[model samples]
Every structure is written in structure tokens, then in C-alpha cells.
Target: MILSVQNYGQNKSIAKDKIKVLENTAQESIFVHYNSSLFMVGEYMYYKIYCLNSETNKLSHISKIAYLELVDKEGERVFKQKIRLDNGFGQGDFFLPVDTRSGNYKLVAYTKWMSNWGQEIFFSDDVIILNPYSNNQRDFLESEVSKEDLQSKSDLRPSNSALSELNKSPLQLFISKKNYGKRDEVIMEFEGINSKKIPDGEYSISVRKYSPVFPNQKKTTVDHLESKEISPPTFDNNITLPELRGELVTGRVVAKSTDIPLENLKIAFSVPGEDYQLKIARTDVLGQFHANITKPYRSEEILIQLIDDNVDGLTIELDDFASPFNSDKVKFESFRLNPEMNDLILKRSIQNQIENAYFKVKPDTITSNVNELNFYGTKGITYLLDDYTRFPTIKETVLEILDNVWLTENKNDKYVFNLRTLNGEFNNSEFTSLLIVDGLFVKDQDYFINNFSSNSIEQINIVKEYYRMGSQIFDGIIDIKTFDQNYAALASKNDMTALKLNRQTEIKNYFRQSYGNESSKDLERIPDLRQQLLWLPNFEIDDTQRITFFTSDLKGDFEISIEGFTHTGKPVSILDTITVE
Candidate 1:
């Protein structure tokens, strides 16, 4: 005998008079709260889930129905998923994907939908990552996140994303040398350029260079410092970068009996003085010293450091900021001035060098060096910009993403207002009083279309304002934040009005079920705030002219009688300020 009776709100009939196969409901252990495991190195997050009905009974269509793996404590599995089904009875949601790594995981629900051919409905459990890239408050308190489809962002998940760069433009810091009373040979350079494709990584010019010029104490405190490794060389228009190689003169150093100038000691170049072995030059914050010459020390003969006893010496005057017989010496890099240069601090340094010239880009054609130094000055990163060999590619680097974050120019109201409708002749398709957003409603469009259904939103942040009847319809109030939730991340408009507003207006009216199958034990014995505002779905009820008036999708109110509006009944007028769109 083969019988069947699947019912979850009724619907299932197939008894061909009976034949066999009715063994479904037994091995059930559903508990998956597997939560979004932690991650951040490359970043990703997901947890969506669905699978219930106490376990689809009398089910058979190819048997073995459940699978969702992700193991990694040596038992090794990293990720897996499978859930069979063909017709009739159904179930779907199962995202998971954080990629893998960082400890104890397992959201298994196996019995073999294919772990190479299954047989173990044993429901394993243990997903506890803790800090994947971190969004803490304990993951918004273990988020349950309701409704979240928000807007069906077409499946986007290309490994986090970010590769747009054009860095290197902070060059020129030629340290203090010009003081050649007899040329003490000293050089230290670090200019940069590699054809402006900058992408070599390990960069840190930092610079706070010091000189033989010392004497500015704040109760001093110097500590012997040493860090050497140069000789990679690169000079000239390519922009010089001898790394910092060539400086050997480690002499003088004694404090066992009061040898003046040792106010804050910590010296070590390994002492030897005068050309090769006494690299004495590492002092700053007032006891200045710096050395980096690769030869021609102005006709050589070095041997200076006379004090702490490298056995007394004399032959000073190191580079007075460049002067091989000086030629009208102007000034810039090494603080060398006197040629009278001060047009209000070089016109405020040429207005911050032309407002930092779009934050200096010009490099990275795919890791050739120089990345993200404001690449074309800010937008959501993912840029291998010029010659683009595959960067920022999630369908053409999406509106060059700049969820708007780069500040330093007066506050302007904490900005972010770019919600469209200012152009295309600013139309609201006959406004039925739209513009809701302020929320306590259907999961706020389920967290605004499920956390950013994929890029295209370069700016939009109204926040509050939407009159009605008296008309202001909505000057402010837009809540779509998305950085990447992936609905194919839309946002194109310079008239593409993001593919012409996506036209989807179909709500063939239907609403009458104030409360059915409710339960918190009937919401603790009927507190019926009018059938829970009759199921939301109507907008504009803020600047307080008070008019909720919805009738479907559930219920609605805020009605203070102006006939409790929704005007569902089309009336005449009050001061005829006319309102019907």
C-alpha cells in the first residue's frame, strides 16, 4: 500500500490505490542556528537558512534528503551542501559561505544527498568562529535578521573585492646636508617613480630625518637605534632610490665618566670613524645626525666625531643642503631657505599642492607598484585602474564605489544625501504618497533590500521629510545603504536612472486576514493593536499630519480621522489643496 498526506496548510494527494514506500518521518534532528561564522582576511559573511516542517514526511522521491557541511578541525571538509528535491513538496534557503578557516565548524545535516553517496542523518553541530572581520556587539547580538530578501540581489560573491590603486606622490625629502665648510661627504636619498605604475608593496618612507644640527631638549631621552639594509639602487628620472646604503663611520661613544653630549644615550653604528666603520649619524629631536653618502665626500678625508673618545677628532661641516659651488640656490626640500621664499607659506604650499592633486594616483596596472593612495581620489576600492588587467571587476567596477567616506572639509551637516529624483525631470510616478523608510515595519524593507543589493548607489541619505496633502510629498527620507548585499548591486544614473527605475509596480490588491495562526500563545491573549496595524504597506506618515490608513498587506492606522484617510473611498476635499497621485 502506498499512501501520502503532506499538509502544511493543506495540499497533497496521490494514492494510486496504494503500493508501498511510506518511510519518511523518523531520522529528524533539525537545529541549525549555525550562525554566521567569523571571517576577515579576505572577508565574507552569510548564514541564511531554511528547512522545516518537522521534516517532510512520507517523503521518497530519491530518498536521502539533507546535507550542509563545513568542517575543519582536521576532520577536514571546508565546505559542502546538498538537498534533494524534484517536484511538489519543497524547501530552500541555505547560504552559509564565509569561505572557511578559524576553528570548530560543522552545520552538517547528512544522510547522504551525496557525500559520495550518503547514509548518516546524524546532524552534527559546532560553528563558533568569534571574529571574522568583526561586526561585533556579538554579531549584533546573534542576529536573527528577519525578512532579509530585501530585493533579490542577483547572487553576488566574488571574494570580497578591492584592487584599485595609483599611489606614490609624496616624494622629495632630501635630508639636511648643505654645510660643506670642507665637504664632509654625506648623502641620503629616496625619490620615487617607476613610470607611475607603483605597486611594489613594503613601503614606508616615514621620514623625520635629522642632521648634525642638534639642541632642543624636552628632558631628552635617546635610545641606541640600528636598522640597516640597502643597496638596491635606482636613481635619476626613474626617481632615485638607493634605499639608504653607504654610511660607515661608527666611532665615539663613552659614558663611564661624564662625557658631555651624552644627555640621552643610545648609539651604535659599530664605531670606527672617517669613511668606513664609524657611521655616526642617527640623532634627532635636537641631537641631530644623519649619514648616507656613496662616495665623493667632497674630495674626501673624513674623521669627525671627536668627543666620547674615538680618540679626539676634527674635520667637520657636512652637506649644507647641496652646494657643489652653489648656483643662485633657491630652496624647498631640505628646509633650506633664505633666498626669500614665503608668499604666505608658498601660497599655503600651492593650496596644499592643488588640494593634494586628487590624492596622487598614476600607478598599478595590475600590481606594478603604487596602490590606493587615493586612486583618482576616493570611491569604493577595487581598482587596477589604467590598462585594467582585472581589478575592480564585478561587472565593470560598479560606479567606482565610494560609499562616501573621505572627510576634512568643514562639516556640511555630516553629508550623504543622494537619493535620485532630482532630475529625469524629478517625477514621482503619481505619488500614492510614497517615501516611507522611518520604520517599525516589514523588516525595514528587510534591512533595506538585504544589506545593499550590490553597488550603484553613489549617494543617498535624506533621513526625514515627507509631507502629504499639503504636499511636500518627501524632501528627505531615503534609507537604502547597501555596500554589497548583491542584488546585482544597481546604481547607474546619469540618466540610466539605474536602468530606468526598474519598473515593478504590481500589487493587485488583496488583504483581509488581520491575524491567522498567530502564536506567542495568541500573542499573550489578544493585545490586538487593531490586528497589528492591519499589516503595514502604505507610506507617508511622518511630519505628523498623521495619516496611516493602509488596508492590506496586513493592516494600518495612525488615523486621527480626516475620515482616517487611505482615501480608499475617494472623497471630495478640505481646502482643496488637492492630493491624488
Candidate 2:
């Protein structure tokens, strides 16, 4: 039943060209045609075959023997035929005949070396793909923008070098000899780049996360060198912006009827599975604020919380305005001040002022957690521990409920704890503690079990792994008091610096105490400069006999104002030695 055409050609012995072929083996009458134009997708159809040069193996410069065949689904060779080709891999046509009623078929028509093996049977896509290319891109905006400038020197500061700077997360880009043109030390200087005129959409900010190795100069010949050194975390975040890059955000506040714009208002949006929240922004004069944040492949919805401690502590202001807000005094009218329409007036009545405060909280996530809770002035934090997970202890034969797990830290010297806004005394006390110590969450105010005895804590699973760890992941030393054996370590460092003294460092410290009132332009104040000896290993002045210190600008020259102190830590003698070297 196999159709043969090799013996039927008019010039069978001398036929040196290839032919085209087609087949039908499906339920529905399948149409086989090359819809090539960009045209009606259904117009560029007819019938053709390939005539390969046989010398080269491609349709472009080789030989081809093409044919069309119509066979039954069971491998029965029904009809074998041939067609011609006018163009290569372009618009053309071929037809097939079927005997079956209706079902499905795979009509594959391919040349010996064709790139895109064309298929006639269309089975369109029907599955979801999760490859990198398949995922949606993240949004560049819609994130928090800190008011601080970041640095590459310290990971803590807001600088271009810090990995935590905006837009640097999620994706990391590097320039290396391995990837780029064999170059090392790729120094990108943005001394004249401006971002003010750029539109507000997202753009891929490129930066070199890694540089190449150092160059090596061998004997006579120059070989490729790689030192693999890392620069301190600095932000190519461009160091400075033309201004506090801003945008507009719209919102309304009813209870505090004052038309004054909320100042220093912080808004945070956290995408799930993300390392950090977007950013915290400050409000303008009219309680209006806008934060500039970016996220690639942004999440659909983000978690947002508005906070301002000076104007009002999150829960504190919410508490003070509770009664008035609930009553008619804090009524929210329409837009304007129409007496008949009664647009809610911003009340200036309550004056419970807040000194300092912060919010690192989230909304309640447990059913037992309070439904509606209020905090004054400060913005509401949404993330909180609201669950009691019951676990069985191996040593103790009883079920224990674990509840009120919270985050703790310290600011200055005071401690803070971000607790769930539950209708409980302990947690409320914790919120009060946050106001006193700025944004710190400390150990004392940590949310704990309600009725469980301290002895019942057979296995307290301190979630240390969940925190950014170090000497104080909890942000404060909870286990040991300031100075005993543990103080041994801190005391050792102080004592060690207490070792060698460079006459220069000794003089600098002394001058600062006399001037600047012991204040520093950096994040902290300069140490009391006047309290040091010239010959000590600790003060780090163990340099030379001739000490030289100079004051900035019009402050005057560097004078080694030497002074002696008694055992009681009081100044005994003042020796003013003005050295030249």
C-alpha cells in the first residue's frame, strides 16, 4: 500500500531535483498551507516543494528531496506526491486530503536543515511557566525613601555603598574582567549625572557590585592579574540628589481635625518574602507626604502604615482622640468648610504632646488579637505576634501556649519593644515604653505569656535566627549586666585602647572637650578630649615625641594643652605646650 514516485518520473534516470510532500491522518479535515505575509495569516497559501543542490546540506546552498504523503493513522501509506518551492522558509502552501471523520493529528513539514520546523497541527499553549523570563517585572517606584544619605564605609548609614540602599536589593549587578572587556578597577564616577529631569518611571540603575583582580607585571611579559578585593559598601545611589526627590500622595485624617500637614510622617510598605520594608517617609507642612521607593517585579499589594511621633505617638494619639473622635466633635464632613455641609474641622483642642517616638509594628494577624485598637499621634504598626502556638515539651508532660512573641531593641541607652496592640495591660505598657526610647524595642518591654509561670518556660525558643544578629541582635544586652565578666570584653577593648597613646590623638581629644562643648558633627559627640595622659597605650597616641594638632578653619592652631589629674579624676596642673612638628 506504499505509494512510490521514484519509478514514475519522466526523466527518472536524470532527475536531480528534490520535491515536496503532504499527508493527512486526523479526525477533522486538517488544512496545510504557509500563511506567510504578516498578511491575513490565512492568505499566503498554495502549494510548493524544495529543490536542494545536493552539494551543500542547506536549503540555501544544498540539495533537497521533498514529497507529500497522505496516510491512515495506522501507518498505512495511502498517497505519496511532490510539490515545488519558490522561496526558502517563507510564505507558501501545501494541501492534505483525509478519509477519517474528525479527531486530532500532528502535521509536521520540515526540510532536511530548516531552522524552524513548521507545524500545521495547531495545539496552542495551555500551561503556566515559572521560568525567570516568565515572571512579571517589579515596579521601580511604590517604596519608602529614607531622608538620610547612605555611605559605603558603614553598613548602618544611609549611603550609596550600603546594600540596603534603594533599588540595590533583589538584583545584584557586577563588572568583572570575566564578563566585561578585560579591565580591572572599574571606577564609575557620576560627578555630573542628574536625575531630576528623568521621568518618574522605573529605570535599571547599573552599578558594579564586584571589580576585577589587580594587575600583575611579570618579568618582561604582562600577565592578567586578579586581586579580588571588595570596596566598602558605598552607594552609587549617587551620594546626593538635586533635592529631596518627591511626589504626591493623597489621604485624609478625620479625628485630628487640624488642617496642619503632619510633619515627619513615616509610611512603610512591605512586600511579602522581601528582606526589608520599602521605606519610611516624612510628611510635609499640610500633613501631605510622598515617599520615593522602587521594587523590580513589584508585588500587587503592599502593607502600608502612617507614623509620626512628634505630632502624635501612633497609639497614644489614637487613644487621646478616641472619645472626641467617636463623638460629634471629630465629625468628618465633605470636602470644604461649608457650614451646611460641615466639612470636618481639624480640632486644635487636645494638647498631649509627644517628645519622641517610632513604630516598627504591623497589623494584627491572629483571631484573638484585638479587633480595633488606637494609638495617638504615632502611626499604627501592622505586623504583630498575635498567636498562641501550643507545643508539647519532652521533659515536662504538659501542653504549653506560646504567645506575645515580640521584637526588642535599644536607642541611646533606653530600651523599646514592638508589641501587638492587644486589649491588655502588659502590651499597652510596652507601647508606652517605645515612646520613651525613640524607635528602640528592648527586652524589659518584650511581650510575653499572660499567665504562664516563669518556671514553666522549659524551652523558650528565642527567635534569634529571625533577627539580624550581632553582639546585640535584640539591640540590647539582655543576658548580662553592663560590666562584670561580660564587661570583661568591653572593658578589655577600652583597656587595650587605654594602652598606647599617640601624643597627637591625646591632644585632639583634649581640644574637642575645651571647644565644641564635647559635641561631634558625626552621628555621635566627640569623646571628652581633656581627660587623657600622654604616655598610655590605650589612647592610641603612641606615635612620636613631637605632637601636632590643628583646629578647623578659624578655631586656632593645634595646642597640646597638657594637664595632670589626681586619683579623684580632677584636674591638678595645666601645661600648655605648643609644638611645631
Residues 1-581, candidate 2: write the lDDT tens digits: 01111221111111122111111101110112211111111111122222221222122212121233322233333323322222221112222222221211122233322211112211111111011111231211123333231111112212243213322212122212122211112211111013312112111111111001111101100000011121221212111110112111123222243554454444432222111113344444433333332222112323334433333322111101000001111211111111321111111001001100100111112112122312121233221122334333311211233233343344543333333333432343312322111111112232221222233222222221112221112211111111111221222121011111111000011111112223333312322111111211011122221222222211111112111111221211111212111
**Tens digit per residue, CA lDDT, model 1, 224-311:** 0011111221211111111123322222223333444433322222111111222224333333334432221211223232222232
What does the lDDT come to for candidate 2? 0.21
How close is every model to the real structure, measured as TM-score? 0.14, 0.18
Which candidate should be chosen as best, given TM-score against the real structure?
2
Alpha-carbon runs more than 4 Å astray in model 2:
1-256, 259-261, 308-581
lDDT over C-alpha atoms for residue 179 of model 1: 29
Alpha carbon deviation, residue 556, candidate 1 (Å) = 61
